[model samples]
Target chain A: MLHFKAEIKENIPVSKNHYLLTFTPLAKTPVPLPGQFYMIGIGNSCDPLLKRPFSILTKSDDSIRILYRIKGKGTTLMKEMKTGTVINVMGPLGNSYPIPKKKHTPLIIAGGIGIASVFYLAEKLKGKAIVLYGARGKHELLMLDELRGLVKELHISTDDGSYGKKGTIIDLLNEFHVNDKHLIYACGPKGMIRAVSEFALEKGLKGYISLEENMACGIGACMGCAVKTLKGYKRVCKEGPVFNIKDILW
Target chain B: MNLEVSIGKLRLKNPVMTASGTFGYGEEYSDFVDLNSLGAVVVKGISLTPMQGNPPPRICETPCGMLNAIGLQNVGLKKFLKEKLPYIRNFDTKLIVNILGSTVNEYVRLASALDEARVDGIELNVSCPNVKKGGIAFCADSRTLGRLVSKVRKSVNHSTLIVKLSPNVTDIKEPAKAAEEAGADAVSLINTITAMAVDLKTRKPVLKNITGGLSGPAVKPIALRMVWEVSRTVNIPVIGMGGIMNAEDALEFMLAGATAVAVGTANFINPSSTSDILEGIKIYMKENKINDISEIIGGLLIDNPDD
Candidate 1:
């Protein structure tokens, strides 16, 4: 909800085609929530016109991290940036993970790059959650070493059989026994989210899902990122990038 | 320090109005921008009925600008008055609603509906299709523009009618004169230039709608040229826009011929863009020892060998 200049401490490749950007705030800010995001922009350039929105992968007292893959024109510029570059970041935007009132078994389900938003949620749970991550292959399963130490039980799967249990994350869900009393949290591709939402609903587990939609203002002002819910069209950047699975129409 | 300038009967506190679609009814950036400090806040396009905009991939970045096919997505007139008007009325600044429709009757109906409404003015977006004429835009043809605007001008009694012209036309002056002759109090341009972006990988257009309206710094020069041309042809006040991101850009529009300028796509770049531009204008006026903003309007220098 605040805008400040943050200097990039580092932006190094963490995995194939992925980078881990670490930046320190030029101004003081309250600690961002687990699912909050930042609208990051390079200095003065107008071509990429608007700042790109990225969820906070992790954070510490002096620095914050964002995980991104080179998607288009904007990230292409980001990939070549040198360290110590001053990036204009408007953050900790959007709503956060639905923290339950009482402690219970937390099931963190993530697919591919969706793991960027969930890593902090795991930290908030104090290594007491069970995380299930799915990727196309072993190479795509990013931040595994860092992620393994954060969760109590870490389950991984790769479609090409180069890693643990082969198949989609949905197939992994079928193999694993999700406890009846657990609360579910999910993020990933639309199909993956839809399947997990359906799976969680059928299991009668309370859950929230993070959505990825092309955004304009990233802060709900533009009304560009619209998602149809039971109530009709709502802004993903405003109403939520996070929503209860039960309330979402699809 | 006197920044107030009159656009017909409507006097703005300053010349900075947040462009339609960029400001989002003044609620989205209320935390970041001081709405009351602005001269005006123009909300997005509202049609006769609710509209679901184009499918995804609606925006694509270009060289110093961006193309968007939001397709004028809005809550419709009924919903806008019911759900949005009350919230907008709370602001101390002038409120101008930008409205669009497919036909002449729709414009008149909307004009009649808001004639007595609490808002200050109405900006007609003539960039939309004239459905009765098989989707030719009202702004594209001068006669159609004259007919639709004059009929709309007759229906609204309490509000100033400002016609927003598109730059897609060949001779922008023709429509500006047409609007003036049809009783429009003021006119604003250029909505956006028609353009397209292609994805090299897919070998297809980037936006779902193949083409969209381009806005931002890339269109500023083209918009300035049109504003200069239209202002000379029409006696009515001209509100210029297109790639107006900063106070310098606003001053450039004013110097060219715009009575007022709206900050458009820059709102996405900086959430507080409106306020920053307003502040910059104030500083410029102060440093220049200018007492009033009117002194700077149409102050451009054009030279000829004879002179």
Candidate 2:
């Protein structure tokens, strides 16, 4: 991993309380894979202290994009950033999503801001995957047009019934026909991911789920962002941000 | 022009060392930092057996700092000697292993084993606040600290024995003096301060451990004060650390009578913090026309009316 200052290319509001930030690295960095993340420094000050972790939303030769919600001090500060603002970035960290077997069909599930973690994976699937995207309302369903254009099939839901089939993403999953031939990839709140984990297990479907936690050193040194699993506690910044669905204890 | 400093008989090429629990095994940061540039690399706190650490939500960012309750998770002494030791031996820097244990025998065993392997230093971690046993217990009382240090000192023949003191105590000088009298070569202070954070929405503690050791720029002033106090109380060299983020902070520790300084939380913020601080120190020395880094040790000047 490399740590260098990157100049912001764009910071645009995508949906309610959500934004897409793109930056060009001042130094050459390894290509980041889907499901991998970068720790973005907030400001040039120590008040916010630790760098915030963001998943790679998209990447090109010159710039990389990350979708974030203004939920805390770090993101709020990030939203005010304009083009040409240089910020420290350490990246292409953690493991990437595994490719589905040739015989298996890819099924991607995302909830609310969790869409940021899987958007790059959808792009990699190259129109071969089916996506189930959900949010609190239609305004929070970010980058719908772009996601639809990339995937072979796209389904959406909102808790407030302001958009596609009302209710949780788990409710929408109940109507879908899933089996061992379908490979599931998910990222969402703990409740949604837990429900999806159980659903995938019941159907005997193999899958991977991206996890999130408050982290200190984005490297393995701090051991701060640990998540319990069948084998043992794993660092979310190192051992994962993505894990085999069957491996998670909860 | 000289940056060399001695901790007991161990001579470091410079006074900048990576704090224990922050630098890992020296390999995790090899890609971002040149281990050869560091004066010393103090690995994470190791125990007799591998520890799993605390549960999730082990850390939370606070104002100007962060709280971590990692519970001293380590690969155990066996793994360190077999796997970690060999990898770090490739680097030109001195290696100091930070050891933790539940009893005096455990500490003695870890010290002798590491000394037998010929590591450069052994830092006794008696102030890690996250664990339930062995850590803060030994250092809470000066008497107990003295006994522990004396026993560990006996087992350590080749390596330097540095007792890492706790800031949670009433007076930091007691343990520093005790460690010195008990044959410790040097003393490092302060470990993270005991602190906590709460979530209003959930009405619960932010960390599953409820409380964690506070470190970062927030604790720097307190650490500096404690280092100054202990440095005056003890004859042995003082290794100062706690939220040392930049060269200015590291230099401040030296002015407060610290012979050497360790970079801890700054490593998490910037992986190359130790190297950066070392380079900054050199620049500071050159700009001020200071020839030796030792000149800055205990350099703080307090005007006296009598003078």
Candidate 3:
């Protein structure tokens, strides 16, 4: 991991309450993996003290992208950031989703803003994976055009009937023929993740899920951002922002 | 300019140190900071056994600061001495172990073990509740704090004995004097002030622990006042900390009577805060034509012509 300044190339709204921020590193940085994240510092100020952790949405030759929703004070400040402004970034943090086995086909599941964590994986898998993207409504869904072109099959769901299929992402899963031959990779709200975990376990499928938590130090130092696992409590920032669905106690 | 400062018999090359629980075991920020450049590196609180700490939502950001209730999770003493100690031994800096315990004997044992390990210093984290004393914090009562300090002081032969004071008290001076009277070589203040944040929409506390210690620029003024009061009350060196984000803040503490200052929450915001603050302090001394850093200690000029 490294700490360096990166200049913003773009900070544009992608959908209602969602933005796609792109920045280029001034110094060389290691290539971030699918589920890995970066802690982006806001304007140099004491209030809003800690940097906010964001999952890597995409990475190109010279730049990286992060998809964020303006949830609180930090993200609200991040929205006001303009192009060409410099921000401190520490990155390629936490573990990544393991590669799919030869026998198992990849099933990428993303809910709302959680799409940020799985987008890179979908892009990397390209024509080899099927993606199930869900949001509250049509306005909340993001990167549909890009996702359609990247994955083998793209399925979408919305809580309101304004989008593809009505009901939660779990209801949308009923339409697909999933089995042990499929490896589920998911990132979403706790309810969605729990449902995915149960779905995977009942289907005798193995999978991984990415988690989100309020973090400080984004490194292992603070021992904040803890999540319970069968072994005990583990740091979401270190032991994971990603974990095996089977290992999770819940 | 001379930046050297002494904490008890231990002389620091500079007056800047990394606060416990913020810097990890000195390895987490090694990529961003030069460990050798720091005056001291105080690791996270070590207990007799590994602690799982609080459940998720362990930390939350508040205006100008953050609240953290990490529950002092650590690798336990055995793992620390075996794995962590050797890793940090690579750094050319003094290592001060901040210890937390539920009983006086626990503190004594930790102090003597760390001293035997030949560490540079041992800081007693008196903010932890003394389970033996009905869950009241060791620093909550002056006499209890005195007894704890005296026992740990006797066990600590080589390492400098420093008592870390909590600001959640009626009068900070009482505990400062109690520590000195009990043979503590130095005292550091203030550990984070207890505070909480609530989610209005959900009507719940932000942290799973309900309340966490508040640390950052928000607590600076309170820390400064407590440091000033404690410095006047105790004869031993006062190591001030709690919201020291920059050189100006550190200088403010020194002028208010602190011999040294520790950088805590700033590390979360900027990994290289300690080095940056240290560099800033040197520049301040050079620009002001101050020769020795000791000149800044207790340097506040108070004048009352009417008196």
Candidate 4:
């Protein structure tokens, strides 16, 4: 609920048009939860009045980082934002992933850009997590070394065989020996989520999935980002951008 | 500072108003904002009876705007008066009820009910573009628009009646003049424009309703143009709104001849936008040495209509 003029610390192009922009908050940064997101805007264009939601990549005192891909006009403009330029940043909004108790082993699965949210989750669960990541190619598979440093084991998969296993991330997860003793967390393409959701259910594993939707108010007011669930359609920005894999209708 | 504003004889605590539909009866945003700071809250479009509204995929994003096919989804007038009005009155802000009816009688009935409830004002929402029936949206035609307003005017004795005009018409001035001729106390112009979006992969319209009203920064220019046009065409005060996200945008609407502007899609971006716009207006007024906000109404100089 606070709007601070943040200065861009760096905007690094990762692969193709994807970028990781780090910003220094002009105000006291709220302690955000894992899997939570922030709404960011470029300049003063009401054309994109609504802020673009980016997952909290990582955070430090007085600063926060966001990883985004150039998908549309808003992201395109965001890529051009120069270092030292100030932009409006709001929130550590939406619910975060629930943390596990002592000595809990959690399996984290992510696909492509979905890896952004899980990076922080791995950092939060350091030494007590296993990571399974998938991307289209070697270059698209990001944060492997960083995640490898934190997890007990890091599993990798690529569609083009340019990386570890030659199949979807779900394929890699299926190949790996995982049991009900471990809790699972995933974020990525809807197709991948649908695939892995079945695997989690078959194993009777408790898991959480982060869903993406075209949002108006990142807050609860608009009701623009309602996702169909087992109970009913709920606001993705409020009731959850994160939900139990079992609660999801997909 | 006493930050209240007035719409004709009705006094508002501030110049911030919740545009119709987006605020959902002022009860929804109460948790996020102080209702008293707002000039007035215009609730969702009300019909004679309950409406289920269009099916989903009711909203889609365009270039800079979003198309919504809420279908004037309302709780009807009787339920609104019996349940909704009392709750709204409990809030510390002025409530300007927005009414939509398919016939003149329905409009009169809805307006009379609001008068009986002793609400602040009636914003005749005759310009709803999401309906498929005749008389459901009277502002599309000059004669029907006049008839609807006149009927409500005759029935409501004390409340100020405003005819909200439609932007879907060829000439917005025609309807504004019609409402004024029919004895409307004031007029608001430029409701959402008729629009549709497509899903390229599915080869189908993105929205389930096929067509929806477009709003946000994309519609600001067109809204301002129509507000300027309608302000010149009619004698009544014009409350202009469309894509007003900041003080500058609000001032643009005022300069285009809107005495006060309503914040719609911008509210979706920031829950505190209404209060922000009100504060922004005050800053602009002090910086420019302007005492009254009405001085800025219709301040934009147009050498020719073609511009």
Candidate 5:
């Protein structure tokens, strides 16, 4: 619900093409909950006209962190910014991950830059959760030091054998003995999330999945990010960026 | 500073309104902006029956705009009347519902159902293809657009009718003229221009629908030109929209001929865009010492002389 220029406190390169940017608000704002996102307007031109959506990676007392990968022109512009750059950001948008009422083990699933929101979700969960993170290689795994202290358990998978188990993260599912009793919160590429969602359904596990789609208004105004479900189409920017796996129609 | 503007019988508090499909019922961005501060709110396009719409990837960002083939996906009449309308009725701004249908009867059905409700106006969508029209949009032909507008106007007598014209047509003025002649109170343009994009690496269409409507700042110039042309062709008021991101952009359209302006794709960049544009317009009016906004409407001065 805010749009202002935030000064980049630090723009750290986490890995190849991936970056972790932290910014301090020039103005006061409310704290963003985990899974919430911001629409970042790139530069001052119209070439990358649409503000790219980025999830909250983590937040401190005064700074908001965003984790991103250089996938296209938008991110390419982001990667070139220096530490003192001021960027236009509008935020705390869409629904946040709901705090579970019932007592159940939290199983965090992250794929690549999908790891953006998990750190905050884990902090809220507070060392009561287990993390399953997947990347292409060792260098792709980000913020391992920050995550290790916040979670009770951590599992890793790399597509290339240069890191952990050399396969998709879905291959590492059995180690957790995942079931209806465990809660699964996943974010990743569609194929990976789909496989995890199907596996979760098959095991009768319950959790939410944060989806990504090309969008216009990150708010519900533009129906650009509609995701199909049993009910019908829902806006990924409003009704979710996080939705119950049981409700989504793959 | 008399910001009031009108379209037929409906008078707005200001000339600022959010374009349909961009503001999504007002409440979505209510947290970011005050809904009562604007002139009006045009909700997303609604249909007679429920629509599944086109599949994902529904949108792709182009140079300065984005292309989307949402296929006018929306809650049906029953759900909207039961669920959405009541919630929207509570907001302070004028409520204009943009409606779409595959056929003439479907349009009538939707109009009749929404008639006499708390809604203020209905925007008929003739931009997209109809099943009965064999893939041609009604607005593509003046005759068909006139027939559809007249019939819908007859069926729904309670609210003002605004015809939203598509920009893809070769001559936008013809459709605007047809709507004006067929009892439409006003006309709004331009609906997204038909466009498409591709993924060079994957060698596939960027949007699953293959082609979509292009909208955003990229379409502003073209939209301004069309709004000017339509304003000259039609006798009724014109609600201009395209890539109106700020007050200056809105002012350009007003001077061109649009009595009112709607912020479309710009809403995505800032949820408070409508009010921001409203504030911008007020600032401009103050800076120029203008007392009334109507004086600027259709008042663009051109230096080119007739041949």
Candidate 6:
């Protein structure tokens, strides 16, 4: 991948602890895929040495948008970054989400912060999908308008009953009663993935899960993010940050 | 506009040198960086024999740095001379070989093999934190450090030898003095400090190796302090490093008694850190109206207890 000193064009709050960052690259670089991530540095502060990895929420010819939550020092620094400030970025790394060939009934499930990945996925497959989004409350329910515009059937559920259906996102998924003919995709907290993975497995539905781990060198060289699977320990950064539901051990 | 540095008799066009281990044999970063523009490329720590290094989870992120426990994973001196050294010779920049050994004899053997090759210099990697044996073992005692350097010194005639010191010791001066007495032409300090990152949730050590060397901007202050201390202790030229990301930081090392500086963890964060530091140093010199940076060596005033 090529390293570009990018300038921040926009930074806006999408939800609590989450913001959308748009960067304009200085040079021509590789276009980011739906699930691919970028390693970004916010400022010259000593708190962050390496760039923080973020999912490519959207991509265009010259600019790339990253959706991230203010969880740690790196993200906090990123939150403070002003528009027009330059930061170093090296990425469009990791594997992308598999694109569906035919227009199968698309079933998109997002848990809590997991909604970030589906932004780009929905942007690509707009008007031909169904989105089931779950969050703790209305404030945490991110990109609802965007997802609603993209999908045909939009289902919203909050744990605190602040949104459409008062229950867990998975609870709402169980009530959908969709047939096994649909292709499913999901991202969110680990617990949500395990729940959705088990549910999708029993229902005999085709689904993919975007997993998360604390990665040092987000490339394969570090081998920090190892997930147990049928093929033994596989690197999440290389093998599959996005794995088919059946491939996951949990 | 070609900037280079000469460590003793060996000459490097640019003062920007890649610290060992972060750069894998001067080849890993070639795709991202112009290897020839660098002052020198020091490969990973090579032992007398091949090493597997530590188990999985070899690295972890610290406050503003990284802890790495890659226990000198190399193909040994024989393989290096046969394979790695020949390929490096084809490049334009200087190649400094960082060697780690278990004993004095092993250091001698490694040095002898390096002397036979077309390499520019040898940086005795006596401070690698990854290995439990032969790496930091040589740097613990001044007497042993001197003996290790002397053995390598006597073995190699053509190559300039630099003894890299560890920061884990109580007093850095003792080892710096010992290396000087052993006829080391130059010295580089400090290597990563022994550190461990614990997962608060799991209540277990983050890295598989319980301990690893900490590097990056987090260690910059500590490295600068040690460089200042070691430079004052030894008369030989000192190559300073640890957490240096920019030219101002590199200049800080130079002012604190380092003849040159190495950019390690910064390379992981920014591919252009080395070049940026080089450019910054030149611009700093121009802005400060300083013709030569050599005038600023040991510029810090020693704190006075009885003023």
Per-residue lDDT of model 2, residues B120-215, tens digit only? 999999999999754799999999999999999999999999999999999999999999999999999999999999999999999999999999
Predicted candidate 4, C-alpha RMSD: 4.1
* Tens-digit per-residue lDDT, A55-118, candidate 2: 9999999999999999999898889999999999999899999999899899999999999999
State each candidate's clash count. Answer: 0, 1, 0, 1, 1, 5
Of 1 and 3, the candidate ranking higher by DockQ: 3
TM-score of each candidate's B chain against the true B chain: 0.97, 0.99, 0.97, 0.94, 0.96, 0.94
Q: Of the true contacts between chains A and B, what fraction does model 2 have?
A: 0.92
Instruction: Report the C-alpha lDDT of model 4 over B85-170, residue by residue, as the tens digit.
Output: 88878877888888877778878888898887787889988777777532235776799788777878898887878888888888
Q: What is the DockQ of each candidate?
A: 0.56, 0.91, 0.89, 0.24, 0.71, 0.23
What are the models' TM-scores?
A: 0.93, 0.99, 0.98, 0.84, 0.94, 0.78
**Fraction of native Cα contacts reproduced by each candidate:** 0.46, 0.92, 0.96, 0.26, 0.76, 0.28
Ranking by DockQ: 2, 3, 5, 1, 4, 6
Score chain A of model 2 by TM-score against the reference chain A.
0.98
Question: Which sections of candidate 1 miss by over 4 Å?
Answer: A28-30, A101-104, A198-206, A246-250, B128-136, B305-307
What are the runs in model 4 whose C-alpha is more than 4 Å off?
A: A46-49, A101-105, A176-182, A198-205, B1-5, B23-35, B43-64, B70-92, B97-118, B122-124, B131-138, B141-160, B177-184, B198-209, B269-272, B298-307
Q: What is the C-alpha lDDT profile of model 3 across B1-307, one tens digit per residue?
A: 7999999989999999999999999998898899999999999988877877777788888889998888887898899999999989998888999998888998888888999999999998987431222123789899999999998888988999999998889999998999999999999999888889999999999888888888999999999999999998888999999899999999999999999999999998889999999999999999999999999999999898887
Winner by DockQ: 2
Model 5 Cα lDDT, one tens digit per residue, B126-199: 78532232124788889988999999989877788999998878888888889999999999998888888989
**Candidate 2 docking quality: incorrect, acceptable, medium or high:** high
Best by lDDT: 2
Q: What is the TM-score of chain A in candidate 6?
A: 0.95
User: In model 5, what is the error at residue B282, expressed in angstroms?
Assistant: 1.7
Candidate 5 C-alpha lDDT tens digits along A32-118: 999999888888887898888899988899999999999999999888888989988888778888876567888999998889977
Highest TM-score model number: 2
Give interface RMSD, per candidate.
1.7, 0.7, 0.9, 3.1, 1.4, 3.7
Higher lDDT: candidate 2 or 5? 2
